[model samples]
Target: MDLNLKDKKALIFGSTGGIGRSIAEALIKEGASVYINGRTIEKCKAIAQEIGAAGFYAGDLTQKGIAANITGQMITDHKGIDILVTNTGGPKKGSFLEVDLEQWESDFQSLWLSVVESLQKALPAMSAQKFGRVLLITSLAAKEPLPGLTTSNGLRAGLAGLVRSISNEYAKDGITLNLILPGYTNTDRLKALNLSEEKVKEMIPAGRLGEPEELADLATFLASPKAGYITGQSIAIDGGVLKGH
Candidate 1:
């Protein structure tokens, strides 16, 4: 299946590791000119070199407005990006009582606003060109709340509203925007959670944690020219873990 991505330029955030890195690898494999992002220049460049990415950008999106600036630079330097995939790091973990107002605000700035700012900068150029693909990599927590993840549960779900509303505005311009909500994937982040695989597998009907490549393949297809008709939608790549309609 040709994704029709031979020369599309893609900028991926949080590409140093985990699911982000998997998506980056998939894009490059499909012949996209990929640029990766990380917080540190040395790590970003090293990953770019190892992965054969076209370049790297350094920015900590937790800080306010940094994503906007990064996208602005991409537009200025490369005349706008054809595909943008932004994956924000998980927010501070806490239960409802454990999280305070300050924590909520912090999550808003880090998880929510960062992606918004990046899209703000890139969407215009895409509209002008009449072509673009935007993929937001969130978590299954966005749909089904997990224990001790109050921030992720609340803020990530908010992104669904953002995608639905904003995607409608740009659909006529040939740009597709969607959310990729992942469940327990086999990544260092999941390993760090120290979850009992036996228990988690009991919950997921698929009987195991997902692989990064599985999620990445879906992302690659969505970002392709062939997926232009799919937009304003939030698709869960969870192993039948999400039961909502």
Candidate 2:
């Protein structure tokens, strides 16, 4: 249970709220120094204060310069990051034919390409130290392809493929790259969708949506030394909602 994570540094994207913040809190609880990232400085600072002296990075990762800026700042402050949690907001809900080319490109940049940049920035240090945990917080839509989330479905699936390929390339370097697919978590975004809690619970086999902490716990474990053998996997934390193995 120690997780052996003390003193390790983590850079978690989209940490202003929801699952990303949950992951940051869990990492801090495990004694890891975490850099919480968000687009605005105020939100980042606020969350960092609430989470206890967390390092904060404010940037829009969808913009090319912002990723480098964040990585640069972190390196200057803490030398390098050991764990990278690549998480972001999902694309707008719409059918495949409804989404335009710009929407597709933007979604790819926000949800998938940002991970590529973050890894490129953080990998050298992790490889040099022979210690790294790269966990991409994806969605069950990557596999199940929900009707209203066609953009998310396509982009997240591509993200899964990217993670799979990199897991193979980096396993020998002591870097474990894996994807965590979550289903129906209770978050502000989900709440805003306006479905009754009971109605949502009925759809999932577990009879309830997953909690942010539940997904956070899985991410923490995957980022730990104990999960060294779990690379190249698309592990679903969907409470049996995902049917297939």
Candidate 3:
């Protein structure tokens, strides 16, 4: 399980905390050159230092042009990244009727459009090198819609479709695009929902919430050379919560 990830350059967005930070730590342990990204410079730099990342990128992906700007800066600094993990914070939780048009537009921009922009910026370098691993951190809502996550259910599912289409087009170029669906992971986002661990565990067959590192392990593998043949797949790490075929 060498992963053959040594010296590979990786860019992970939303790495200041939670699942993103866990993924960054895993990549660093696998000997990849990791870049920690967050909205604030100080936070990103602190996490980068803590995780021994190669560098850090600061920007808000929700804002216009930010994804392209971050990718451009990475290209200028490291030439280009071999792996790109597009991880973003989830939108506010609410029923479909509770969400407004503005919220939908905002969520679409941050969760969907920004990802497209980042890929557009990073793909050329990946194509030129004939190597790339794109791992998107979506959620179980993408597969089985959650009760209170209307926005995520819609946008993340859309992203899944986009990943499949792009993966087919890029597989010939030595690039693999895939989605990682994390279910009830023990992260800040989960904590913010004020969900009782006992209550949540009761719903999962595993009888426990997933650890961030659990998702990180899979992400590390997906972003490595070993996973070259895997593409356009939405793999869930939801502890049997998603009982769909």
Candidate 4:
């Protein structure tokens, strides 16, 4: 199946490693011109070199104005981007009672506001071209709240709502917006939780943690020209961990 992604320009945030890196690799395999982002210039450039990315940006999206800066630079360098993948590191884990105002503000900026800012910066160009794909790499916590991820659960849920509302407004402009809710993916973030593989497998019907590349494949398809009709939906790649309809 041809994704028709050849030469399509993509800008993916948090692409230096992990699931973000996997998605970048998948897009590259489809012959898309990919731009990766990281917080450090040296690291971002190194990953770009390793993956043969079209370019890379060094910016912290948690900081105000950084998303606009990166997207503005992309527009100048590549004319316009065809695909935008919004991803970032997850917030600190804590129970609702343990979370505070400071943590809430920080997490909101990092996980929620950054995505909104990036989309604002990138949407005009996409609307003008009448073609775009916006894929958000959220987590299953957004739908089925996790035990200790109060910040992520709240912010990601807000983001899911935002995606659904905007997707309706943009579908007519030939742009699709959707979210990917990953569950127990094999990544550094998951490892940091110190979850025993055996224990995690027992919880999942698939009896194993999902591979990053597996999620990447679904993400690439969502960002493809062929998935224009699929939007305003939160699709889970969780090995049946979620039981609700």
Candidate 5:
């Protein structure tokens, strides 16, 4: 199916690796001109080169001014973003009691504030164009808490709340805001968790960890021109790991 994303410009954060990289590659394959971001210029450039249809931007989204600067640069080059994929690295695994104030603040800023900053810069142009797709990559933990992911559980829930409110406010203006929750996708991050592949398969009803391409395909659809009516929803691509409605 043609996503109608040919020539659409997308800016993807945390695209150096993992799920973010998957999304970047998928968008490029769908004919979108993508700008990939990472903390290091070399990594971003290397990935962009490998992906073939992407540009590279190296900036620390955790830094106060970096998000604005990247947004401004994208606008200057591409006029504005047609799609924005908000993503970042997950925080260190631990319980709430094990987290300190610094960890809390840092996680909040990286996981939530970075999205806020980028959207603030991109929303006006999106409104003016009368077309926009903002896809936030969150986790199932947002709705179903996990034992060792308190930071993600808390921050992603807040991010979903923000998406819900923004989707309502922006829907009338022809913009769609939504969140995509990816549960146990097969990526480097998941491998780092060190569960045996067989154990992962047993845990998920689908009997396997999800492929990055699977999540990326869904992200491409969400950002497609045909998906305009899907705003204000948090759809999970979790291989039935989340049984809740």
Candidate 6:
């Protein structure tokens, strides 16, 4: 499986660490000209050099206009992007009623609105080129609600609808849009939660946490020309944590 990604230009958000960093590394290995992005310039720069990325972009996605600005800058500088991946940290963990009112707006701004803005700026260019791959790195909470993740559950599900709507409209343009749902992946973010790995493993049929590289490989494949026919779909890369399709 060549994946046929060599020479393609890719821009990935939240690539400084965790799943995003792993995906960027995978794309570079597949020969894509990858651009790493994060809120911290030094971190993104260091990671870009460490992974042999083509470049780096720094901006806080939670702020309005930042994503669009980054996309616009990327297009102007690199001509156009063939693969675009949007990912960010999840909102603070809390149950529905326990979350503060202001937190909802902040979550929407970072987790959802930023993606909307980036796509609005990039999709037209992709349509013109008649070649593109758009991947939204969401969570398994999109399909199944998780305790203490009410914000993620709500916004991630909304992204599924967004992917379906946009994919249908753009497929004729040679652009594919889809979601990759990661469940209990072994990453620093998951480790920071302070949850017992044994307890978590017990809940999953596979009896283990997914590796970051495993999810990264799935994303790399989806971002390649090989996955052109697979669009408007949500694929989960969990360790059989999701009981239903």
lDDT of 1 by residue, 1-245 (tens): 98999979899999989999999999999999998998899999899999989888899987898999988898888877899998956776788999999888878877898998999899999999999999999899888898888989988889999999999899999999999999999998887777899999999999988999999999999999999999988899888998854
CA lDDT of each prediction against the hidden true structure: 0.90, 0.84, 0.91, 0.92, 0.87, 0.92
In angstroms, how far off is 186's CA in candidate 1? 0.7
Name the 10 consecutive residues with the lowest summed lDDT in model 6: 236-245
Candidate 2 lDDT (Cα, whole model)?
0.84
TM-score of each: 0.97, 0.95, 0.98, 0.98, 0.96, 0.98
| Top candidate when judged by lDDT against the true structure | 6
Candidate 2: tens digits of C-alpha lDDT, residues 57-164: 888866765666676578668987788888877668778788899888887788877877777788887888888999888899889987688878877888877877
Superposed on all Cα atoms, the candidates' RMSDs to the truth, in angstroms, are 1.0, 1.4, 0.9, 0.9, 1.2, 0.9
lDDT of 6 by residue, 1-245 (tens): 88899989999999989999999999999999999899999999898999999999999988989999999999999999899999987678998888988999889989999999999989999999999999999999999998888999999999999999999899999999999999999888898777988999999989889998999999988898889899999999888888767
Query: Which portions of model 2 miss their true places by more than 4 Å?
Result: none
Per-residue lDDT tens digits of candidate 3, residues 1-245? 68999999999999989999999999999999999889899999888998899999899988878988898789779987899999988889999899999998888888998899899999988999999999999999898888888999988988988998998899999999999999999989998888888889999999888999999999999999999999999999989998764
lDDT of 5 at 198: 88
Q: On residues 203-223, what C-alpha lDDT tens digit does candidate 5 reach at each position?
A: 789887888889899999999
- Which pairs of residues collide in candidate 4? none
Q: Write the per-residue lDDT of candidate 4 for residues 95-140, one digit (tens) a residue.
A: 8889999988888887888888889989999999999999999999
lDDT of 6: 0.92
Off by over 4 Å in 6: none
Clashes of 5: 0
Supply the TM-score for candidate 5. 0.96
